[model samples]
Target: MPVDQPHSSAPDILHGWGARQRGGRIRVKGGGQVSQIYAIRQAIAKGIVAFYQKYVDEQSKNEIKDILLTYDRTLLVADPRRCEPKKFGGPGARARFQKSYR
Candidate 1:
């Protein structure tokens, strides 16, 4: 299911391993790293996606952006759970959604 971006403007990357689940909804839990984000996208584009959540500091926001652009696999879409509040958070802060796995 990979997007096969050879003809498109897709980035070069792919998804990774299993999710490390969490417990009762914490307030600021994250899933993957910036790299992992793209990894998830690649998974979806490739159609074998497993997701990771990332809880980054203000300093890392740019890194996350890099991940979004440099890798076609990392996308703004795909992982809706990751996009929502209980996980990825907002401009001022992030909220935890209680890890879905463990």
Candidate 2:
């Protein structure tokens, strides 16, 4: 996948920690730079764990998980924050309709 240079570091981290041995394509849906990067990293991390599960022993799998967590807690954890819904009387999430009096 072609990611922006600023957001390219996360994947490099995974590659540095032995993930380069495994290769596969990833397709990510909608999101901005940071979100897309997070999704890609999470997918890569999960892929690594799955690969280990299939080929390596349990101890090594746990070690990989620990290493990922230590490097970035969010690598395996999904972010919980979402965009707030727009209010009924507002044009945006938090903005209220403008007051006008003649």
- What tens digits encode model 2's per-residue C-alpha lDDT throughout 28-89? 89977767777887888888888888987888779888888897888888889998988789
Model 1, 1: alpha-carbon shift in Å?
A: 7.2
* Residues 37-85 of candidate 1: C-alpha lDDT, one tens digit per residue: 4554454433222222234354444444455556543354554453433
Give each model a TM-score: 0.23, 0.67
- Flag regions of model 1 displaced more than 4 Å: 1-55, 77-102
Off by over 4 Å in 2: 1-20, 89-102
lDDT of 1 at 51: 24
- The per-residue C-alpha lDDT of model 1 at residue 15 equals 22
Model 1 lDDT vs. the true structure? 0.40
Ten-residue region with minimum lDDT total, candidate 2: 3-12
lDDT of all predictions, in order shown?
0.40, 0.78
Count steric clashes of candidate 1. Answer: 13
Number of clashing residue pairs, candidate 2 = 0
